[model samples]
Target: MTATFFQRLGAVVILLWLAVGLAACSNFVKGGDNRHNIPLSGGVIQGLRNMGSSPGQGMVVRIFKEESVLEVWKATGAGAYRLFKTYEICAYSGDLGPKFKEGDRQSPEGFYTITPGLMNPRSNYYLAFNTGFPNKFDRVHGRTGSDLMVHGDCSSRGCYAMTDAGIAEIYALAREAFKGGNTSFQLQIFPFRMTTANLAKHATSPHLDFWKDIKEGYDYFEMTRTPPVWDVCEKQYIFNPAGSAPLNAAGPCPATVSNPALTAKLQADEADLANKAEAARVAAEKKAAEEAALKERGAAVNNFFSGIGSGIGGIFGGQGRPEAQTGTTTTLPTPSTQRP
Candidate 1:
């Protein structure tokens, strides 16, 4: 099959990004636990305290792909997590949403657990941590991938890549949390911020239903200011279930999310999203109408000049220029077909 211009252009851009990412990864110094032992900087420690959190309390990592933001939230004395820092993601591959399969080049989306064992100090790309892709939701949905990581060196094939310095601090925070006896932490990845407006913007995506399913967990965390206990049932995310019963990914969902406040919040967001979508539609139509009107006016002006040029040519017995350029249109003579 022949590739269209846009497809060819996209392939070229992807290759270029891969080249740069590989070069950046190669520049990083690897094979050392010493760098992993680097402590949190003074400014970071101070920033944590300002948010009522201290190093090693606990942490949750959230990534928003479209926004290119990775946020670190630490458990505060109040037991609720508070935003500690937001890091700019230097690189990530593929489009928004979950990875479909191995070598798909997509960075996975959805909830994951990052345990101590997932951390890698000797990573070829500075420090790194596996994202534990193909989590229950992915498995239930038959998704596949491996070695999905949040790593340094601004490189990514199917990973989230951060700058060396940015990831150093992020890795340090994770280390501190593990030292504080945390066996694992939640890693939530979203396509975007999941606001009502953002959802409205993507309401027509093929992944909208999937996104809405994940947004349940997102809403729970937003309302509670803590990671929601998540599990997969019936191939979708179920949050804060009531029972202690073990869940089967392929089986029917045994329990549903139980937060009334969050439910109310979601309902409101849906309503607001409808309004936002309508407003956006109207705005787009208005813009299109204005552009069409402008185009018509420009054409009228061009035709007026063209008529004048034709009249002048006729009056001057072809002494006027053979062609008349008007706006974006040029008039030319048709070849004679009466020759014997």
Candidate 2:
């Protein structure tokens, strides 16, 4: 009797909690935490130490929508950033596409710059940072949206949501980096892993062209392990442009200059990815063709057996063919016709 009572009470508690959470605007609505005051966990700090990095080093963030993951990278003594940690996204709104307007409920995918001012220690989600949506490229295209964020609460309102524990650690890292004098960090959000194979797989999607365009920046970071100094030109992302003159977002791009070694390496890598995609496409086509041929052979064999059965039926059933069958049968009276 006591156990049953306890079980009933437990169920009631869970129901009440879920009801309250679901009632909120985002479950991230209008609340806060003391978690931000805490420092990075010992485990995270040790991992940074393993990479010869400290908590206060420069940091960059990356988010992958399809994968539902976020990565935090830290600058190492080698002067290049290394992957520091990864967190699972608890929730995000909309499908895998860029946000176009306010209240679209779409999580954005693009480059954003986050400064200390963008960080929110008192966010309703516990900890949050603005994603700076509708960036230069978005503006050039006349896309509209605002207040996009990566935050804690395990729920989202067109935001990247992480568990409270996860965001606590992430927030601490950014705080320490700011104390170490880093002005701002880059946040790169992608539709997916941004591999050539993935692009090829999504070739039929309407967003392919846009993805290819952002891929230039993606390729650069993959090669250098550093966020490129990027800007908008011709309404697309351009990295490491040579001059300081402001670019016209809708105008032609200016000349770019980058490390020759890096350029060569990236070109070679791209070629390899392209080759792999092409090979996959060709293999898929070949498999489809083989399947079609197999299907055709099966059909022919079935038809052959069916025809034999029909012939046998006609001979045994006293009918020349299905169409020749009549309800009444006439006897063969050849003598009368011959005499006539």
For model 1, the stretches where C-alpha displacement exceeds 4 angstroms are: 1-33, 42-52, 318-340
In model 1, the Cα lDDT at residue 105 comes to 97
**Number of the predicted model whose lDDT against the real structure is largest:** 1
- Which whole-number lDDT from 0 to 100 does residue 339 have in model 2? 46
Regions of model 2 farther than 4 Å from truth:
1-33, 94-97, 287-340
lDDT of each: 0.88, 0.85
In candidate 1, list every pair of residues with a backbone clash: none
**Model 1 compared with the native: what TM-score?**
0.77
What lDDT score is found at residue 206 in candidate 2?
83
State in Å the error of residue 173, model 2.
Answer: 1.2
